[model samples]
Target: MSANARTVHPLGERLGKVLPPLMVLGVVVAVWWAVVVKTESAIFPTPWQVVTGAMELVEDGTLWEHIRASLFRVGAGFGLAVLVGIPLGLWMGWVGAAYRTFNPIFQMLRPISPIAWIPVAILWFGVGEVSPIFLIFISSVFPLIVQTTSGVHTIDRRYLRAAANFGVPRSVLFRQVVIPAVLPEIIVGMRIGIGVAWLVVVAAEMIALRSGLGYLIMDSRNAGNRYDLVIAAMIIIGTIGLMLDGITRLLEKLKTVRWRYVR
Candidate 1:
């Protein structure tokens, strides 16, 4: 096949894959429009009105400000979780004794909801930015730890045996073989943790901080001038989440592309 033909073929395939979701999105918007037209409720603004509100907020820089604040918190919290959780999980996964010692404590804390920690966070951090940021970290960290542990434990026993047979050092085997094998899992964990961080950060902001998308939604509700902005903020949040997820998928594809021909 010609170069152009090869490129166009994959492009067409990708477009085909994307079309169904686009169609579903269109149908959802249509249903939303129909509902708004039929009900005319003040609480349920039309999609067009929400779009207009989104535009107005963007033009006035209010939307960006809230988005920036939320992003900052999410970024900080997710980064911390990834840095700490991944290593700890790897250690726990690699060593039986470590896993035995830490797994119980991790299980004990994992079930606690992020919201449940709000009172303690506020008491500890005093309703400052730290409190909400800490809440985000708490919500996101456990999933990463669990996933990372699972990833490490799932490594093929044969690979380790082969490395040991070849006189590869324990440290070398882990760094070169074990780490790479589990990287995909770590990335998956990071993606999930980021999503949870985004969710918890917004809730934390709504409760503890004076600014962010969550705070904007609360403020708009209190003002009662327009509910459309609240919906707009929700759309923005969903879009951001999708974008973050897309990045993770892209990374996965990049890592696995060479392996595509193996099987």
Candidate 2:
């Protein structure tokens, strides 16, 4: 195709991509507005009402405070999960016997819901940030552990053999060959773990905490009827989650785009 045709094609493609998401968002808002109208109750505020409530919260500094609290929990939980999960996963992946011996425990824990562990988490860590952090950790650990091990196990044998033939030390081989080869997997695990971390953070906040958006929602419910604030908080939580996922996806693309042509 000619350069002019290629340029036109890109414009069409970009519009095609942009229009769908915009239309979907529009449809969702319309449905939400319709439901609120049909209900015709202040207890079920419309989308515009929620947006105005969100702005009011923003002006009063309440939104920022809640956002900070939620973000702190996410960071704490995600940091802990990454620090512990990645190393353990790498170890399990690189060693066969270790994988066999320890995987069963992980399997048992993996099926346990974060919400189910709320009572235990509170008992063990108390009703503080630690309890919520523990919940986040539980939610996030399995994906990293499973994915990292899978990635490590899937490394091409020829890569290992080539490294060994060069008399590369075991430590060096892991650092140079194995880590790089499995990085795409590690990033994938991080993506999944980050998602789970976000999911658990909201639940933890609602159950164990006095601040954050989750608490704001519960607090609104208790204050005689602020469904507007409740809906606003939910929107904020969803928006932040979407932003987090997008960031991780962009990071993954940046890390792995160069490997696209590899067979």
lDDT by residue for model 2 over 1-263, one digit each (tens)? 87876675778889998999999999999998998798877578888888888999999998999899888888888888889898999999999999999999999989888889999998898988888888888888889999889989998899899889989999999987788777888778888888888888888788789999888999888897888999899888899999988888775556443483255
What are the per-model C-alpha RMSD values against the true structure? 2.8, 2.2
State each model's CA lDDT, in order.
0.87, 0.86
Question: What is the C-alpha lDDT profile of model 1 across 52-126, one tens digit per residue?
Answer: 989999899998899999998888888888888999999999999999999999999999898999999989989
Which regions in candidate 2 have their CA more than 4 angstroms from the true location? 1-3, 8-14, 255-257, 260-263
Candidate 2 residue 246 C-alpha distance from true site, Å: 1.4
Instruction: Please list the residue runs of candidate 1 whose C-alpha ends up more than 4 Å from where it truly belongs after superposition.
Output: 1-8, 254-263
